[model samples]
Target: MDRPVSKVREAKLELYRKKGNIHAKEVTGRFNTLRWGMVWLTQTIFYGLCWINWESAGSVRQAVLFDIAHEKLYLFGLVLWPQDALLLALVLIIAATALFLVTALAGRLFCGFACPQTVYTSIFTWIEARIEGDHLARLRLDAGPMSLRKLLIKTAKHSLWAIVAIWTAVTFVGYFTPIRELLPTVVALKTGPWEAFWLIFYAAFTYVQAGLAREAVCQHMCPYSRFQGVMFDPATSNVAYDRQRGEPRSNRRQAGQTGDCIDCGICVQVCPTGIDIRDGLQYQCINCGLCIDACDQVMEKIGAPLGLIRFASETALVAPEKHRPWYTRPRIGAYAALLLIFCGMGVWTLEHRSLLLVDVLRDRGALLRETAEGEIENAYTLKLMNLSEVPRDFIVRVAGMPGARIVGEERFTAEPGSIRPVSVTVAAPSDSSLSGIQPMLFSIQAADDRSIEVVEKSSFILP
Candidate 1:
C-alpha cells in the first residue's frame, strides 16, 4: 500500500508537468457571441465575393481579376499596373500595424476569434462534437475497436470536412480566375495546370490543418504563437489565472479551509490546446478564454465566486497600485498611429487614381526631317491606353510650342480596354524658333468627355 501511494504521487506529478487533452465544455457568454458574429461576417464576405461579377464596357467583364499574365490588377473601378505595386506593399504594412495595435490592446484577440485557423478549427471541432459526441465520448470512441457505427460516423465527418476544404480552395482560386468559368472547368477536370495545382494544394492544406492538426497547428506550426510574447506588456489583456483568489486549492467540501478553487480542473479540460491555465501563461495559450468559461462554470457549481480564471493582465492581478489604462500604453498608441497613417494613404491613392494612360516616344532613327513643304518636322509614335470601361475617342494636341501644328488627323479612336498606337508628325515653319530637343507636351482629351485627359511629355528635335 505504501509503494502504491508513492507511485500515485509520482504519476500525479508527471501529469501536472504534461497537460492532458482538453475536452472543452461548451459555454455561452458575451465573448462566445462575439466569436460567432465574426465567423458569420468573415465567411459570408469570403464566399459572397467569390460569386460577384460585373460587366465592364470592355470586352472583358469587370470581375475581381488579378491578370498576372498581363501585369494588371482590377479592383472595382480601379486599375493597378505593375508600377503601382507600392499599393500592395502599403496594404501589407497597414495589416501589420493593425495586428500590432490589436495585440497591444487586447492580446491575441485576432488569434482567438478572427484568425482563419481559429475560426476553421472551431467549425471543425463543432462538426466533430456533433458526430462523435462530447469530449469524454470522443475519447472513448477513438480508443474503441473498429465497428460499422464508428466507420459510419467517421465517414460522415470526413465527407463534411472535404466539402468545406474544397470550397475554401475554390474561393481562393476565384480571385484569379472567373469563378463561373473556373467551376465548370474544375468539374470537367480541364483546369489550367497552375490553377489545378493550387486548388489541390490548398484543399490538402485545409484538410490537414483544420481537420487533423487542429491544435498542433497553433502550438507547433504557427510562428505567431512563438513570438506573441514580444508584443505582450503588463497592460495587455490575456486569459490569465487569478492565482491570488484560487491558490492552495482543495475539494469543494473543505472550501473555506483552502482557497475558492475546488481543484476540479475544469479550466484545464476546456482548453483546446491542452494547456493548464493554472500553470501561468504558456506559448500554447491562444487566449481563447474557453478556459475562463469552464472555470466560471466550476466556480458556480461549487457556490464560489466567478473569475478564478479570467481575461486579465499579470500586473492587474498582482500589483494593485500600478494599473494602467489601455490607450495610455505606449506601444499600443504607436501601433494605432501607424495604422491610421497607412489607412489614410490607401484612401488617398484610391481617390486620385487615373482612368487612362499615355506614353509618347519620339522616332529615334531620324530625329528631324525636311518635309516637301520645306517645314521642319519630327515623327512621334503615341501610345494611348484606354483604361476605362467605355470606348473613348481622343483628340491629340500639342502644347509648349507656339504655332506648332499636327500634320495629319488630330483625333483617333481607342477601343475600351485596348492600347492603340498612332503615328503623327509635328511641324514648325523652317524659320520658326526651334532648337535641338525642345520640350513639348502631347495631350489627349476624351471626345465624349473633355474632362478626362491624359498627357505625356516628350521633346521635339530640330536639326
Candidate 2:
C-alpha cells in the first residue's frame, strides 16, 4: 500500500505534466473577421506606401523614406534633419501612450488584432488550412504515415509561404531604398551586397517566425506578453473561462445537476497559443477570445446559454462589485491626458517649423580688421541650410547697430535640399563708437515665402 500524501503528490505531478500541453483548434467568429480586416488594411498600407514617389523641386524620392545613411527623413512634403530627432522621440511616446490607453480600456486589442506576429501567423495558418484541410484532417495527416499526398501538400504550402515571405522582405527594405529601383535590381539578380543580404535575411526570418515558430513567438519570444500583466487590474476585462458556472464539469447530459459546460474542450481546441482557458488566467493567454467563439458554438449545439467563455473582469465574475467605466479609470485618463498634450506639442512644432535654418560662426582666429577704406570689418562664416522642397533665394541682413551692413551682397541663392556655406564680411563706420563684442543678429528671409525666416545671434567685435 502507498502512503496517501505520496500518492496525492504523484497524481498532482501527472496532472501538471498533462496540463502543460494544449492543442487548440482554429476558430471563426466576429472577432476573427475584424482581425482579418485589420490584417488587410495594415498590410495594404505598408505595401502601397513603399511604391509611392513624390517629386519636389526637380528631386524625386519615396514619399515616406527614412534615409538612415543621409541622416534625413522624408515624409511627403516634409523633411526632417537629424537635429529634429526629438520629433521621432515624441512620436514613440505618443504610440506608447496610445497602447496604454487601449490596453486599459479594451484589453490587448493590439496583440489580438493589429500585432504583426498575430496577423502573419493568421495568414500562414490560413494557407496551411487550404493545403492540409480542416483541423481533424490536419491532425490526422500529421499522424498518418509518409505518403505522396502528404509530401505534395507540404511542398505546396511551403512554396506559397516562401513567396509571401520574400514579398514581405522586399516591402520592408523599400522604406530605405527606392522601391522602383530596388525591384528591378532584385528581379535582374543585380542587387548590391547589403540589399541582397537583407532581402534573404528578412525573408528567412519571416518564414521561420510565422510558418514554423507560430504561437511559440507569442508565448515565449515576445516580451509584450510578459509585461502585459503590469497593465492589468481587477477591472481589466480579459477572455476568461467562467469556472463558477463551468466546473464540476462532465460530459453527461444530466439536467440541472452539473453546470452548463459539457467538457467538450472546444475552447481548448480553438486556442492558437495552446493554453487551456478553463484552467484560469495564465500568462500564455493573449486574450484573443477565440475560445469564446468555440465555446459559444458548442453551447448552441447543446442547447445551453452562450458565453461559457467570454470577456469579463475578475472582479465582475468573482465578487459582486460595480466596475467603473473606461473614462473613469485613473490610469487610462492619465494616459489619455498625456497623449493629448504630446499630440498638441507635435502639431505646434510642425506649424511653427521654418523653411530655412542658419548657423553663424565667427572666425575666432582673426577677429576685427581695419579695411583700406578706413572702416572696421569682421569676417564670419554663414551656414545656410535650405529645408524646403523648392529652391530659395534668401535676403540676408545684419541688425543691432546703426550703420552696420553686409559688405558686398545682401541676397544669396540656395538650391533645393542643399546647404550653402558662404564667407561674409560685415563693415562698420570708423567714427561710430561701437564697443568690443557687441551683440548682432543674422537673419535670413526666403524671397518666395516671407513667412519663412531664421535668425542666429553672434557677437560683432571691434578693434
Candidate 3:
C-alpha cells in the first residue's frame, strides 16, 4: 500500500538501539533552541486562535470558526460558502506542493522541526526528563523494582500528561464549535454526543502518540518517513555523519589515531529517533539535527574542528566542490514551479471571486401557462445566496427571449450569509419568433451594487 522502505546499515550499536523506551539525552545548541522555539510558536497559535472574535452581520462570532452546522467557514472578514470549495482545494494543493518542494531540497526538514508528532513528542519527553531525571537516571528507574516513591512519581507524570492531552483536544474542537459556548457546555456536563466523542478520542490519540509511541510513530507509522527517500537525491541536504573524518573511532588517545571520533556514543544517546547518523542515511532518521548538535559539542571539547556530523549532501561529502546546484535539479525545480503556480492561482481566484451565487429551478406547477391577454407565461424559482457579511436587497432580471419581461416582484432581500428563494414570473407575446422550450437566462444583482451579480441559464417552455 505504501512505498518501499530503505534499510538502515547494521552496526554493533544495533544492540543498544534494541533497549526499550529510548530516553534521548537533552542537548543544548542552536538547533535545540530552534526546536523549542518552534514548539512555543506552534502551540501558541493552536491554543490561542480560537479565542479571537470578529464582528459579522451585527453579531460577534469566532474569527476562524468552521461552522459545519451552517456549512460556512469564517476567516475574519472572509466568509466562504459551499460554492467556494475550489478555494479550499487550492489551499490544500498549495500546502502539499510546498511540502514536496521543501522535502526535495532538504530531506525531512518538516519532520525534524515542525511536525506535530515531533513537537508534542519533544514536549512530552522534556516533561519526562524533568520529572524522572536525566536519560541515565530514567534507565535506572525503569530497571529498578517498583516502590512507593516510583508509584507516586509515575502517577504525577501520567496525571499531567492527561491534562495536557485533554486540553489539546479541547482546543482542537474549539475550531468547529464556538469555544466560548463549548467550554461552558463541557464544564456544565452538557456537551453534545459528537463533542464528547471527539474530546475523548483526540485526547487518547495525543496521549498515545506523543507520550507513548514517540519515535515509533516516525519510524513505522508515518507515511512521509516511508516515502521521503524518493524525493532525495545525491545533492539533497540532510543530517549526515562524515565517515571519512569519523571512521576508525578510538576511545583512547593513542598514536595512529587519525580519526577525530572518540567513540563516545553521545550522538546516539542524544538522537530522538535513536538511529546513529553513521548508519548512512536511514529511513528512521528524522533529520532533527540533535545528533549534529551533540557531535559538535564533542568536537569542540576534543580540540577537533566542528562538523563531524552536519547537514551535508552525499555528493557534497564525496566531492564538496562538484555538488550540483539546487536550481539545476529537475525534480526540485518542478516542485518549486508547481508551488508557485498553485499559490498564484489561489490568490488570483480569491481576488476575482464574486460575492453572489445564483441558481434557477423551473416551477413544476406551471412550466407554461397563458394569461388572459393571450401571452405565454413561465414561472421560475431563484435561489440566491448572499455571501456578504451584511444583509442587502437584490434585483432580479430575465433575458434570452424577445419582449420577455418580469410580471412579478423584481426586487427581494436576503439575510447576510443566508440563502433566499424567490418565485419569479415572466411573460412574452404568443407571436414571439422563438417557441417550444427556448433557452432563458436569469440574472440576480445586488440592488445597491452593480458589481455584485450572477447569471444562470434555464429554459422557458412553450406548446
Q: Can you write out model 2's per-residue Cα lDDT over 293-403, one digit (the tens) per residue?
A: 888888888888888888888877798368776778888878889999999988887787777888888887788998898888998888888877778899889998657
Error of 3 at 432 (Å): 5.0
lDDT of 1 by residue, 255-334 (tens): 45678776666666667787778888888888787877778878787778888888888788999578788877788888
The better-scoring model by TM-score among 1 and 2 is 2
Model 1 has an lDDT value of 0.80
TM-score (C-alpha) between model 1 and the true structure: 0.89
If ranked by lDDT, best first, what sequence of candidates would result? 3, 2, 1
Q: Rate residue 414 of model 2 by lDDT.
A: 87
Q: Tell me which of candidates 2 and 3 scores higher on TM-score.
A: 3
TM-score of 3: 0.94
Q: Tell me which of candidates 1 and 2 scores higher on lDDT.
A: 2
Please provide, for model 3 over 302-397, each residue's C-alpha lDDT reduced to its tens digit, 9 standing for 90 to 100: 988999999999999989998988989999889988988999999999998999888888898867999899999998888888889889799998
- Give stretches of model 1 more than 4 Å off: 1-23, 58-63, 67-74, 77-79, 253-257, 431-433
Q: What is the lDDT of residue 75 in candidate 2?
A: 92
| Full-model lDDT for every candidate | 0.80, 0.82, 0.88
Best by TM-score: 3
